[model samples]
Target: MTKLRQFSRNLAKNGLLFNLFILSNLILSGCTSSTQPTYPKESIDQAIQDICKKEYKTDVKVKLVGSTLWIYLPIPEGIVEKSNKPEKFIERFVIEQNNNELKDEIVSVNYLIKPVPEQEKLQDMKYSKAAFDRINNVWKVLRRVIFSMEHPEQNSPKFFVTVTADTKNGFLIKEIFYYPDFKKVSYELMSWGEYQHRAIQETEVSPKIIGDTQGLNLKYSDISFEDFILQQIQHRIRLKFQKPEAEKNADIDKEILKIIRYTLKAYGFKDFSTLELNNLATVRKITLNQTAVFSGSGD
Candidate 1:
């Protein structure tokens, strides 16, 4: 009788363990199946092209980088030449895509349309490849550094900067910056609720500021100190300028360095020696002597 009772208990224990093993296997399989790529690359590419062409009347080249898709559209030479407003492109596209069907299909999307040289010709202006290249390199690095600092745990963050130049009115330059919307991510639970890791979409975080000939004369009150620091790091000056013709005799690279020195001096940084200019752009990492306060009024 005692032996039989022991055997019964052992069998029940083994049955419970076996059932748990089966349940766990099922759960693991479900998770794996859920993660399998459901969106085909070809379908996404086709959809983006079709939607962009039909809606915006523009042809786009699609490139898939990891889970995000990049849509590159060349600016129409006519539009860039005639319009003094390149900032309109940023505003128009954001509104167009807000309720579009494409937004639902993709985890993230980046639309890039850098100004073309043909547009410069239309404005009777010459293209400064050297100047533009320097600007591009600086903006790229600045964006990367800032994003990494902000989201240290995030492995891959979607972001891009669009630089547009309009020499029609004293060498106007517009920069449109975009990044993934991190603010929407939720971290709260109810009494009888389950937890979830919410997904977020790309959004425009910074204001689209246009830098022109007047950018050289920007005052301390015109821009926030923090933003000023970033612009210096990116080599993007928001001050107004006189004219490209005035700068024709000046060495742009040297002028940029002078501006950096002047700006740092205003911020009360005596150690200007720490500032370094690489082959492409100005790069610096400095710790302030005091806590810097960013003004609310400046762009």
Candidate 2:
């Protein structure tokens, strides 16, 4: 009887252990669902929209082009930005402005660069507090959707651009955010505040065509971040000194150095070894070494 009773107890213990093992396996499988289909098999854009609609109670337009993902956010209320520094045109006078006797032509130039934020602190009273949250939330959704994909599309986007459109006013703002830097933010290697700051700087509060020129393609491909930055430097120079009547074109050259140094210093980008600034209109170029930029001397 004692032996039979001991056998029954052992059996019960073994059964309990087996049941626990099965339960754990089920739990483990449930956790592995992160690799599972996060969205429908139909399309990624649909998945993003559905998830955003469910999560934020909002609507967003998403388009995935070759190697790029574009998200357009609609704002019924127009974006109101603070005033920018007035452009100072060079005062030049020529009897025959179109004469071939001129050494350099003071033609208008268009830049192929997207604008970035000057500095967060400098942007006091610049943008709405809600704008930051709106931008960051959409970005977080994009990150989550991309990372959760077990198998991405063949084009698998490497670049992410978000555009905010004021539906009422028909004004649009485009921003390109670097994915590697965003991954750093996700991994906690970088702070969220810093990440958001970079994102803010990556957009334009007021974007006008090259020297406000017409017939220029406003939508441009920024091949790299450095290309974007260099274009920004060129654009700032062009906008600040748009005047054909400058006392000296050399002042534009000097302003180029000042703007480059100032803008680069403010943005905190230190990777490049050299930069060649080109005046697309004039075909003139200014080349600077890395040392020349961070040498701690006045521009």
Candidate 3:
């Protein structure tokens, strides 16, 4: 019995010593690991780069486009021609920096439309002209409505101007982001005929009609050019990322455009014109001039 006890005591002592040794080893390793410090900006850029490298396609290229760092995932060259009509198209992802700080991220995407392209000569002139006129008419009406919303004092008609656009028609719009300087950063969509604009005042929701309101009638100067750019980019991203199920049921493209107009209340852009181009040939040069109403109510 004495011998048995001595053996058990020896085992216990050895086990305790082993545990202590392990604990000391762990502490020393942790101290050694703490020697290196992490870099903030390098860490951020590396994380982003790693993520893009793993996930996006091979054709998707990343580059610093101007002040913005862009991940350009261009549509395939073959896909550009009208043969296989893809439902949705992935364009590119953009990251903007402000004062060397991450400003915003934008993903530009497009919807797939029908109407196959013919390699042969152009279609009948009369048919083409009529189609062009129809599209132009819708574009003109939209511009007028947006203009009216930006300028509330511009003769409020008996009825609110009906906001309309070609729902079935495929169009593109661009959104940009910048921070800090108002003059430096401006978000504008490049797509012609597709735009969002809202009335300066909520004519539908008047103060007298809804009596629950206190006297906090703060009017903001219409959307700034900087804010305008962000909203446009947001609109495009939502459409691209929207769930497949939801996109099928909803006019996601149109919904996204409307969201931009309503979200920022960009009731300032008025009287804009753009050149119409043939889809077959690439457009070399295009310029657009838009007049937007300026206000300092918010300031």
Best by TM-score: 2
Error of 1 at 188 (Å): 24
In lDDT terms, how accurate is model 2? 0.45
Model 2 weakest lDDT span, ten residues long: 94-103
Cα lDDT, all candidates: 0.28, 0.45, 0.25
Summarize candidate 2's per-residue lDDT along 1-299 as a digit string, tens digits: 23223322222111222212322333334433244355432376677777767987656777666555667666554433432642222223211111111112221223222222222112211233444445555655665676666454433365667775545433445655556555555555655434432432222323332122121324534345554445455434433433221233344445556666765675676666665554444556665666786673434
TM-scores vs. true structure, each candidate:
0.25, 0.45, 0.20
In model 3, where do residues sit more than 4 Å from their true spots?
Answer: 1-46, 56-59, 63-67, 74-299
Q: Extract clashing residue pairs from model 1.
A: 213-240, 213-241, 214-239, 214-240, 214-241, 215-239, 215-240, 215-241, 216-239
Compared with the true structure, the alpha-carbon lDDT of candidate 1 equals: 0.28
Cα error of candidate 2 at position 249, Å: 20
> Residues 176-295, candidate 1, lDDT per residue (tens digit)?
222332211111111111101011111111122222322222111222333323343232221201111113244433444444444444445432222333322223222212122111
Candidate 1 vs 2: which has more TM-score:
2
Q: Which stretches of model 1 miss by more than 4 angstroms? A: 1-46, 66-69, 75-77, 81-157, 161-176, 180-232, 235-299
Q: Best to worst by lDDT, what's the order?
A: 2, 1, 3
Of the two candidates 2 and 3, the one with more favorable lDDT, higher being better, is: 2
User: What is the overall TM-score of model 2 with all chains considered together?
Assistant: 0.45
Report lDDT (Cα) of residue 237, candidate 2.
41
